[model samples]
Target chain A: MPETIRDPADPRLDPYARMRERDLVGRSGRFVAEGEVTLRLLLGPRARFRAESVLLAPERWPGLAGALAACPAPPPVYLADKAVMSAVTGFPIHRGVLAVGLRGAEPEPGALVPPPPAPVLVLGLAGLTNHDNVGAAFRNAAAFGADAVLLDGPSCDPLYRKSIRVSAGAALIQPFARLGPGRDWLALAETLGLETLALSPGGAGGLDGPDLPTRALLILGTEGPGLEAGLLARARALRIAMAPGFDSLNVATAAGIALHALARAQGRLVPRGPNRGGG
Target chain B: MPETIRDPADPRLDPYARMRERDLVGRSGRFVAEGEVTLRLLLGPRARFRAESVLLAPERWPGLAGALAACPAPPPVYLADKAVMSAVTGFPIHRGVLAVGLRGAEPEPGALVPPPPAPVLVLGLAGLTNHDNVGAAFRNAAAFGADAVLLDGPSCDPLYRKSIRVSAGAALIQPFARLGPGRDWLALAETLGLETLALSPGGAGGLDGPDLPTRALLILGTEGPGLEAGLLARARALRIAMAPGFDSLNVATAAGIALHALARAQGRLVPRGPNRGGG
Candidate 1:
């Protein structure tokens, strides 16, 4: 059953208040999932995060009824009028669906990469400060069947609301862990015997040069500065060839291209039935 | 030399006023270029558009001095304080550089994709309404050395300021044509004897299937509703394989991956000198 919340000041709605501000500092250990697609992802069988509660406009109820019913451990549902919902959130809830998800314990980076011979594909993101890029990286990682994504301390949070939305809910489902501040991810990669392929414009060879190792980590840096000198030296550097004089593709776009190429080379992409639409 | 302006209401700055509003209806036959990099592109030798005027915060003048000096027929330059420039633009001009480029004429679709004999790769976009996606598409097209980009009427304007910024000025450098409202672009592709490959999740084969033809057009559609049935039927359907049950990649990311593949197969990517950075 759904509860009708008339007061914007209700304590139950605390996590949903002033979303923009909360996104910056985050909601302690909780994150928000927005829109119908993401909300469904939060409650899906493969969901890594547990939903604490769901908030939605009265109109969205009928559409989400089936999904809400399917939740094995249904979270509390709160229905509010659009006006009150907008007032509480400090912005218009255009999607009219939002859920608070709990972020459990952080996963260890070494466990994410595993020892060699496991046919693992891991995406390493370094100094990626943009939420959109982080989100897109997760989306691409999931799409290409990457076993995990390891982010350095400088990378933005993949669980941000906008990141979750931009990722098409991959942020919720993709297996990822952040290497705590000042940790050497490269040293970790070396210890695990994972082939590290760092993407840089000045890289020696093309991305299509050779068959990618079954266990490999594709590292991408920020757009303008690219990878640091020390990092590039340690990894086998690879570049995506571009037309003369052009700088580079957007960081997220580059990740997508490189991941696709890696997945194709390693035969990780799933074959689908004919005539089934991607969406 | 740059002229200094004191007032935000100056008639000479009319085109820049209320940029958000101007972006919707557009500045008649003009488009605004933001940031130093895009400004440099507008004044570059291979520029397709003509600069009507350049607006800058006084602080930006030093950085742009060389590019301005290199311009063959320098347009008038106006320098103003950041406050005055921001007021005139109805927003804070953080990049402190803006240029109004003239859209002289629209090129015919056929002219963009030449006759069959010449080796060519073209990108065709249909109903891609997002400015960021359009911009990224242009960036990928430029990076991968596509001959040109042809956008249908339903697609957003690649010349939009945000699009231009996102494209890293590729919108200005890349040769592109809008296939006017309701024009049959597929028919035009047929007339040009170009092989058409439409990307869809339900695509019959993987993207790496066979050697792509020398003259090929890779067509992409909007994210959710993908390419239309009629269009998909007319072109060879291809897809990027993904992990099971995931939706699709961001339209722009998909464009980047597809373009990179096509460019690699066609030997279009430019090889760069060792130790040269992409930026």
Candidate 2:
């Protein structure tokens, strides 16, 4: 059952207030999940993060009742009319579903990487400041069965609301960790015994070759000035072949292509089960 | 010589006025091209569209002078300060570059598809209304050396400003044509003599198999609700291999992966020359 809240200023709804402004800053130890798909993922059985609470428009209650009921210890549900919900959030709650998710303690980078001989595929992001790219990277990583995503210090937070929405909620379920600022990600990959492949337009060769190692870290950087010179120098450099005189694909799109190709080449992709979604 | 404009309401600047509102509707057989990269592409030698005029912040002039000068019978250039430019466009022109491009006559779908015996890769988009996705598809198609992009009637216009910017100017240079509303794109593909492969979550098999034909049309639909059943039934259905329960990749990302793979499979991708951009 949902507690009906009439006032926008209710202290209980503080977490959902001024969302547009709050999105630019930290949510303390929490993050907001928006839309039905993402909220469902947060409350679903496979969720890695725990939901603190859920806010919903009255009309959304019926559709979400089952998922809410399925939670082991369901979070409190607050129901509001569209006007009050919009007033509280400082924007129209078009999807009519939102949840507050707890971030918990950060996972150690090494723990996210599986032990050797396990056919590992990890996506490493560097200097990716765009939330959309970070989210899309996580989505691609999960879609291709990459064990985890490791982000360098300069990358944007995948938990950002827009990213979570863009990722199709993969950021909530995918295993990920971030390296400390200025930390040597390459040295860490070396210590983990994972072959490092950096993607660049000027990479040594195309991505289709069979030489891709079974256990590898595919590093992606921001769109324009790609990975740093020192990082590209140490890792095996790979390029996606392109027509003459064109710029590269958007960074996230490139990550998707690289992850799919490398995952296929290494035989890491899982065969589609009959009951699963078709993509 | 560039004409200096002090007033935002000047009739000569009408094509650039109230850009945000005008973007929602058609531009009277014209399109807005934004950002330095796209402007350069519009004025470049290979551009498929012609520029009617260019508006620039004073600071952007020195850098773009060469490209502007190179245009045969170069379009008139309007110079304005950031303040006047922002007022005219109804938003801050952060990139400080804007141009009005003529759409020209719509090319026939058959004309855009290369005649038989040429290695053809045509991206067929269905019901993709998202400007960003449409733009990204064009960028991916251009990057992977797809001969052209064919859009069904339900798809959005690719010449929208945001689409043009997202396409990295591929929308200006890439050969593209749209089928009339309610037209069957698969029938057109059949007429073009290209094998049709539609991407879906429930696709018959994964995209990795070697059976993909050299000359093919890869069809992509919107992210959710994928391609319509009638269309999917008419074409060979294919899916990107994914982790068992994950949702499909974003349509644009899927297109990038598919285009890269099929282009490589068909030997249509051009090798990186010594001097081209590295992406």
Query: Any runs in candidate 1 off by more than 4 Å, and if so which?
Result: A277-279, B271-273, B277-279
| Model 2 chain B weakest 10-residue run by lDDT | B270-279
Error of model 1, residue B210, in angstroms: 2.5
lDDT of 2 by residue, A1-279 (tens): 899999999998998899889887754788999999898889988788999999999999999999999999999999999899999999988878989999999898899887888778999998899988899899998898888899887788899998998899999999999887767877888888799998888786777776888888999988888888888888888887877667558999988988888888877666553532333
lDDT tens per residue, model 1, B1-279: 999999999999998899999887853799999988899989999789999999999988998989999999999999999999999999888878999999999898788876769888999999999999999899999988888999998898989989999999999999999887777757777888888989888887666756777888889999889998888888888887787767468888888888877877787777553676533
Give the alpha carbon lDDT tens digit for every residue of A1-279 in model 1: 899999999999998999899887753799989999899989999798999999999989999988989999999999999888899999988878989999999898787665767788899999999988899888988888888899888888999888898899999988899887787867777787888998888888676757777788899999878888888888888887887767568888888888887887787777653576543
Model 1 error, position B6 (Å): 1.5
**True-structure lDDT of candidate 1:** 0.86
Poorest stretch of ten by lDDT in candidate 2 chain A: A270-279
Candidate 1 CAPRI classification by DockQ: medium
Residue lDDT tens for model 2, B1-279: 899999999999999999888987754788999989899889998799999999999999999999998999799999999899999889987878999988889998898877888888999998899999999999998898888898888788889988998899999988999887766867788799999998887776676787887789889988877887878788888877777668558999889888887888888766553532333
